[model samples]
Every structure is written in C-alpha cells, then in structure tokens.
Target: MKFDFCTLLASSLQICYDACCTFRIWNLQVSILIFFSLFLFF
Candidate 1:
C-alpha cells in the first residue's frame, strides 16, 4: 500500500512538471505571435 501511494505521488509530480513546461512554451509562442503581428502592422 505504501509503495502504491509513493508511486502515485511520483506520477502526480511528474504531471505537474510537464504542465509547467508546456505553459512556458505556450507563453513563448504567444509572445512571438504578438510581436510578429505588431511588426507586420507597423
């Protein structure tokens, strides 16, 4: 039972880490898009 709980905790931590990385990448893409649009308009 303890081992299963530990495994579950480890998986949850991994998921949270992956989510944070994905968010960072998405934010970078959004900023790049905005910058390019502004440049094109100007």
Candidate 2:
C-alpha cells in the first residue's frame, strides 16, 4: 500500500532527525579526542 503525503513527510523528517543526532555524537567524539591529544602534547 501507498502512503499519503503527510506520512511521507513524517518519514523524511525522522530520517533527518536521526542524521542530525548522529552528526552531533560524531562531533562530540572528535572534540574529546582533540582535547586529550592536546593534554598529551603538554
């Protein structure tokens, strides 16, 4: 069965939200690595 436009939009929004969450976590991990690397250098 086919879905309506609203349902399609909701699915798209969910995908975008998931992608944003993933990116945020990735950014946090990278920052943590950089912080530790700086400490190691000093």
lDDT of all predictions = 0.57, 0.59
Model 1: weakest 10-residue lDDT segment is 1-10
On TM-score, the candidate that comes out on top is: 2
**How many residue pairs clash per model?**
0, 0
Q: Residue 29 deviation, candidate 1, in Å?
A: 20
Error of 2 at 17 (Å): 0.2
lDDT of 2 by residue, 1-42 (tens): 675656755755565566557786655555555456546644
What TM-score does candidate 1 get on C-alpha atoms?
0.46
Per-residue accuracy of model 1 over 1-42 as CA lDDT, tens digit each: 254645655754565566557786665555555556546644
If scored against the real structure, what TM-score would every candidate get? 0.46, 0.49
**CA deviation > 4 Å runs, candidate 2:** 24-42
Task: Report the Cα RMSD per candidate.
Answer: 15.9, 15.7
> What would you estimate as the lDDT of candidate 2?
0.59
Q: 12 in model 1: Cα distance from truth in Å?
A: 0.2
